[model samples]
Target chain A: MTALKAIDKTTINIEKIRADFPILSRKVNGKPLIYFDNGATAQKPQQVIDRIDHYYSYENANIHRGVHTLSRDITIGYENARAAIQKHLNAANPCEIIFTKGTTDAINLVASSFSKRFISKGDEIIVSVMEHHSNILPWQQVCEEKEAVLKVIPINDAGELVLDEYNKLLNEKTKIIAIAHVSNTLGTINPIKEIISAAHARNIPVLVDGAQAVPHLKVDVQELDCDFYCFSGHKVFGPTGIGVLYGKEKWLNQIPPYQVGGGTIKTVSFEKTEYADIPLKFEAGTPDIAGTLGLATAIDYINEIGLDAITTYEHELLVYATEKLQKLQGVKILGTAKEKAGVLSFIVEGIHPFDIGTILDQMGIAVRTGHHCTQPLVAYYRVPGTVRVSFAFYNTFEEINVFIKGLEKAIIMLK
Target chain B: MTIEETEQEIIDEFELFDDWMQKYEHLIELGKSLPIIDTKYKTDDKLIKGCQAQVWLHSELKDGKVIYTADSDAIITKGMVALMVRVLSNHTPDEIINAKLDFIDKIGLKQHLSPTRSNGLVSMIKQMKMDALAYKVKRE
Candidate 1:
């Protein structure tokens, strides 16, 4: 709630921010929660939670059809939320933003609908190896259906993508380039702006999975010039079951509607029906209106804090945790990209990630272990899986210290 | 000893731990002591892949008694499989099929029982029972 822009970025009031998340104060297993699983989902702040409650209590009505004041008022609020999201990503138009379930839903929408116009038999869908399965599977399904190929961009030992290989894979047969803005498992903030420009040169449209990126970084769709960008609200401290897909006006016009229901049509008849334009064309049925409101509130909450301050604070925490983990004997850090985010993945020599994760859980230190829905990435790394501790703006130096201590205890016991 | 006796023994053993850490350390010890599975049965088809861990179980009838052997990349899973072997192995198929193994909850390891945890321990347990059922059917 503190909008102290003049103050130092790193010194932005941690205590105030921590207080906003009610779950952070609670105990997990008789110990205060040390939530390092922000990559999985960020904890909801009181503001976002209250906004959802406020919407249901005050503005519970179906949108677009009703002439009642509740519907009209709430519809304005709903459109305002869309405009809020449009401004957040700096999309060309509010209609360019389509509300879906989450990042997975958004990607699925693009793959299914975008393919109707663009993809043909034997066309390739290029994705990086480090992408979460959300980014991979929808394209994989499309490829399977169309008899198209799913080409993968490779990564180096440091977990950074090999751009030379990506350039080689880009040919006329390439239909779409779907890549993650930030890797869910490795924390590698990919060079998406450069990738976008490269793809645009070839007239290939790119859809970015920004689920992990939006929580930590400021994403400007116009600035990046990505054809499509998708992100989940829940990952950025909003409610689940709500997300956004921002597509360029050109691409939106070309692609057909993904799902069809009552809310999407201009006029209906047995003979023929005209559909509404762009966003409403893609969005069908009753959308997650409450979730959308909570998402806007979550955006407002983050905007007050500023993404620059968050990026700086999180990077510092990442470095501190990385150095601490590096010092531990037999601890090997995964994904050592020069530019990374809050995610830290590691593996102990001769100890399973599950064992470490289980011990950490008992001590109330939450970390994600195993393939993390990026099994190909784990397979590429040749490790069983990784113990990933992803940080948020609310996580502190003290929690990191406790996590290291707990990790040492786990190592001792497991060894 | 009877399967119930073995279950009671495990519950009693876990009762000695003062804290969760000691209990987990003991679980690791049990994992280490699991009977080595035959190398031939360690293939991917035999593997029960969990979201977090993987478990491999193989059972064979020796003198009309089912002898279970298992291994896992994760030690906690190995320990649970080891515990499972202790209660179910070296018993007739009827005895194996009838055994409830509710002592897993009694030992405060109920977290593994939920399918959402992604450990595949639940599937392994079902596989053990299925193996027993097959053996029982063959005997008839």
Candidate 2:
């Protein structure tokens, strides 16, 4: 935190880490790749890529259905992935972890399954003003169907959650409280533990959207005491089409399955059907076998590198980016949360976010532009969209320098 | 040109693409050959809303035909604008409005475009159609 505590904005060394990612070695319009769009999805590590390749080449088979050698091996690999995720979130049981298509699907699963079983008319669902559309829309559907009310917790100008306002929103009627552990657009890290506690006092179940937070920080579900947690594999250093939903066993058992197909049933007949228990009940059809294996591999890779080291390094990069970007003329940095992840959202005066993104692209530096799937939040900020540059642990200070130089050229070109 | 003549010309020109790319050596060179608007046209008022590059577009219904003039701060975008002008210009507003440019795939333009760039192209094309529609409404 001291790196951010002191305002020392200097140049960064991008080439060193650029060598690690093979994609970054390529040319975009005759320039090397400088991808800063980690918030959208982080690039996969070599190990994760190889693991997926290995699965297809060697162990491709249907899981939990067949008795062949490949099937048994595939099932083991799949379950190992679940166990790895259990460790990642520090869940009480492996069965508590359910595989989903991605964070969006995972949140939708909770909204539909849990709400249908437990929620009633006049119940309320609490969400923050900073949530991505994925988090907001699903709960909104549930609220509409059940005739329940949806409430929002307002954020300060600095993008930090208004905890006092959040406390006021919680009441006996509040049945579910869903929030992003880290704001994707603003980089604000919410006080999830306190938020969860506030909801728990009212006996409300809380769900933490960890899509942005899980990749940057260490998330302990037991420590946060959140009833549900969901994150996508692609947001981390893993493959796409895979995500994790961690819920308490009691709740998982109480809720029905989101999708139904082959794997979810224990025994099926035209007359009657018996559904498989807990995690299997939620999973449904054939899962993304290779994606889960790749995710597990990514976890191993992260563990090998060490989470503490990654966080420390990312903190240093975030500070470096913030200080340097602020010094640029006419640049307005969007979020200044006391606690943040590795995100820098800004807009240059007289330059649209799209223009900034394109100019950067020409220099082989990539950053995400527009509302970033948080249009309501963008509307709330009264800006069309922001050019968001997010950092991964592998990104270096030198890359930041190249990005700054590219941005300066872009600004000059536009002005 | 009449809408029928313009379609025939487009068909004739598209048939010459193999020779063009062969002679030009790069697809971008062919893109650059398309006529472009002047720098004066590139303004905030004319700027395309979703492009990563600064793009300005203006369209006119001259003699019942749509004539599009556009420019961009970036080279690739300028090239894209030029290409769009070549395909869209000298055609009846109705024809231009109805025509779906399959030539975009032939040129492999979208592959070179980033997702935002692709979106910008869609927005620009949408704007052109809107202008054509507005013109039709005014005439009626």
Candidate 3:
């Protein structure tokens, strides 16, 4: 409790941190902007923006193919980003990192490639009720194609995954378990370490959806021992169109390439083409070179501030927000997991979340109001959707107060 | 009233409000008064699924004109649905088809009912126009 008070917004000089994000200073709907939609995608910092500009300004070139100096130099920069991401995730090798469009693309790659190698008719892919559409759809696709069963891990009312159900679902028929490290809508941090170890015990591979987790927590893929870990660049204040998929060397090498093209080939004979090694094998066509550099810069930006500080600060904000939200009547909070990240989802009695979101927008505070791409889970709560306010480290106590006031205003307007 | 005149009237009513709160209050008031569609007509086929909310629209042509009725799960969106119903309902097919209701931008709630937001009103407008076109074709 003392530590919570100690980690106040003043501790980090919140204004100084807020200054790094240029858009934070701007107004929306004639009022100062209070962006609480970080769960959708985080706003980029100036450092990441400048790094992107610096890339295109002086370092624009095709990577991994050209014989020219610009091409060679840019290739180094791109691969160096891979190395940085590898180090950040504490992966064993750079080869373990494959750049994709984002988490969706990364999961699709694994679902397609891994299923092709391991899955068969009647084999089960274990997912939870709390999966985002990205995590679910791909596995659904694989199951539909191969006649494999998609076994769902149910959740309790608290939005935490039912481990008993998950354990029961894992058997000789189970091929893999793909799940989010944290629930997007509920903010519940799933016991993925336990989930992974359980699967590993059965010799089944597990893919961790770190899209939500990476921004909030410092992820160590090696420590997690997850077979595959995927996260989006934009979620962690990096550029869009770039993401990382970290797979163990054995799994990466075992599976065939999900996609194959220019960079994916070592030599093409039209008769039988030889594929490139681990990372390149999955990357087809020209990748987002500028985005990769920008992502590395973003990684550097977070590492400089340190995840430990961000985690503590964001936790304090979460507690502060939850307490404030609870003080009001007719406002019911969803996702009351004992262990949650800085996401607050709630529905006010007799008022639609969309109306609340619209009213909040007028007050210049941005919040997401919908199922948040986790339809089944949200529907399980028996509401159309929820108004969600997710946080980043740069978010402040003052911002939360403004948001609580705005919510009060919204409730009055909608009512 | 003619569609254009109805639009101007709506605009003038919105113009009296100095701030967003009053405008939204008027909208909520409008929504509260939206006549409920018959439960028999509130089928999935009649549903206009917005990304954020759902709207069920029922339209029937009488006396060579379209009579529009709609409902929404959200109150503010219902207000917008009410607006759409008020402006274009009870118009002849050609009048409904050719109407250019610019009152939306004038009231400054355009973003709330934007096509990108999938607020159902845009699609409802399209649906109204299509209903008019169907009646027009049937008459011809």
Candidate 1 lDDT, A182-283, residue by residue in tens: 999999999999898899889999999999999999999999999999999999999999999999999998888888988899989999889998789988
TM (B chain), model 1: 0.96
lDDT of 2 by residue, B14-121 (tens): 556554323222323444565566667666778886534456788777888777887654444555566667677767667777877666655444543446443466
Model 2 chain A: ten consecutive residues of lowest lDDT:
A4-13
lDDT of 3: 0.91
C-alpha TM-score for every candidate: 0.98, 0.83, 0.98
Q: After superposition, how far is residue B138 of candidate 3 from its true place, in Å?
A: 1.5
lDDT of 2 by residue, A227-309 (tens): 99999999898999999999999889888888898889899999988999989999888999998998898888777766666
Error of 3 at A132 (Å): 0.5
Residue A251 in model 1: lDDT: 90
* Candidate 3 chain B minimal-lDDT segment of 10 residues: B112-121
Q: Which residues of candidate 2, in runs, are more than 4 Å off?
A: A1-20, B1-91, B94-118, B126-140
lDDT by residue for model 1 (B1-140), tens: 99999999999999999989889889899999987899999998888878888999888999999998899989988999899999999999999999989999999999989877568699999999999999999989
Interface RMSD of each: 0.8, 7.5, 0.7
Which model is ahead, 1 or 3, in terms of lDDT? 1
CAPRI-style class, candidate 2: incorrect
What DockQ does each candidate score versus the true complex, computed on alpha carbons?
0.83, 0.14, 0.84
TM-score of 2: 0.83
